[model samples]
Target: MSCLFSPIKLREETLANRIVMSPMCQYMAKEDGFATGWHLVHLASRAVGGVGLVLVEATAVEPRGRISDGDLGLWSDNHIKPLERIVKAVHDLGGKIGIQLAHAGRKSESRAGIPVAPSPIPFDEGYRTPHELSEGEIQEIQERFAEAAQRALRAGFDVIEVHAAHGYLISEFLSPAANKRTDRYGGSTENRARFLRETINAVRSVWPKERPLFVRISASDYTLDCMTLEETLRLLGCLKSEAVDVWDISSGGIVPTGLQPVAIGAYPGYQIPYASRIKRELGLITMAVGLISSPELAEYTLQAGNADLIALGRELLRNPYWPLSAASALGEEIPWPKPYERAK
Candidate 1:
């Protein structure tokens, strides 16, 4: 029996398999940040195609924190309506789903407005210099994150994942190279981790205990004086105590370039080692992501005790039936849609 096809329970939700559809930005939302019919169909089709879990892309907790004008937002009640429909569609197909609550921070690409960050730094030429957020402003952002978690629950999500990775707001605060403030929000490691810790507590206060809540962190930031894998393990260990259900581990994303260092034209499972290390060191449930495109490779990672789950991003976007195909390739019998039974 392949563990890859086995069910795993997180809190009250039971995933049908280890395969998960990782959050990938659509950049298809309109100015209002509401989910369009395009968003509905895109996410629902993946569920129908047989992913155990479908995690929605990074949704901004505030308008100013958005990566682009096209990014989705869940900052207010108005944004919940359209997203509610999408969640329902996925659930109706018997697929579990989660929303990745996010704040882009310094990485707010500024499509129509000025970018904001922990400090005033430009990613590149013509990239807007970010306005450093003040203490009061930082608190407001934390409140927004809590509010967004409540909204996601009301919108019928089974799980919530705080996106603290990919050079986003939470990750920015944790990176000493980016946060040079002399205030309490910066200076020490504990101070740098303050925002994330507070935000997690705030979100947990509103999120149901029975439902799983996850935090995605860049496991190893390949930057000078940034949070490393050891630090990530320590953070995850603490978060696990705070009821964070799992840690979705990915790497890099501290600088202008994203996790390109780890994905440096690498083959499949390049980042699996990071997942393995974290899981072993922290003894925490982890979701392995990044360049895991092959069925054999994904299975190998699991069999080797690397990660509890496998999150597929671009590969699944390219082929929604990747899991179904994987099951077939592994000679495991996975039920196909009745309509596709003949094809199978």
Candidate 2:
């Protein structure tokens, strides 16, 4: 049997398979960060399409944390029922759903308030220079994360993945290039990891212990003087006591350097090695996310014990039913939704 179709358990949840639908932003929200019909159908379609885990896109913990005005937000109680609808529908249809709680920091393009970051660095050219968050503001941000996780609980989400990757708020703090603070929140690896550690602890406070909490990190910054994989390992070591259940590892985007980290002709499963190393050395469950678009390669990745989960982005966007097609490609039988079983 192909390992890609194999079941895996995390905390109280048992995933139907090893394939995860990685979170991708859908800028379709109507206003005020509410989930609309588009979101319910977009996520539900993937759940029905046979993904073991369907993670909602980067959701802002506060309104100012949104990457755009259209981004989803859980900063208020009113957002719960709309999201709860999607969660219940996914669960009823036989799939698990997770929401990636995020804060865009300097990356926020909402135009409502000045973006805030660990430092005053702007994301890149054409991006606004952000305000440096004061110590009090930092504490508030942590509480906001905790509050967002609490909202997730109320929304009936099965899992919560903290969005610490992709040059967002947490990623800005994690990367040295974006964070140049001389205070306790910067200067050393331990200090730099402080925000993330506190964020995890704060979320874990309100979030139930039995439910798994995942942390997505940009494992490598792919730039000189930025956080290297080694630095990330040291940082993760500091965060180990926080009890992070999984490391959804992705690299780059911590800085806006225009250069490609991989040379021309990068292939599938490019980021597996970084995840495998973390799993081997740090003893953490790691999910490899990159261009892992092929079923054969994804199966091989699991069979080789390179990574615990295979996260796909673009390919899944092209085909919500990619997992079903993949099962057929690998000559494995997985039950399809009753309405679609006739095609199977």
Each prediction's RMSD to truth: 2.0, 1.4
Please tell me which predicted candidate would have the highest lDDT against the true structure.
Answer: 2
Q: Which stretches of candidate 1 lie over 4 Å from their true place?
A: 111-113, 237-240, 258-265
Candidate 1 structure quality by residue, lDDT tens digits, 132-236: 889998888889999999999999999999998877888888777677888887877777778888888889999999999888888777754467767776666
Estimate every model's Cα lDDT from 0 to 1: 0.84, 0.89
What TM-score does structure 1 among the candidates reach?
A: 0.94
Q: Residue pairs in steric clash, candidate 1?
A: none
Write model 2 residue lDDT over 182-221, tens digit each, in one string: 9999888888899998999999899888888999998888
Error of 1 at 226 (Å): 2.3
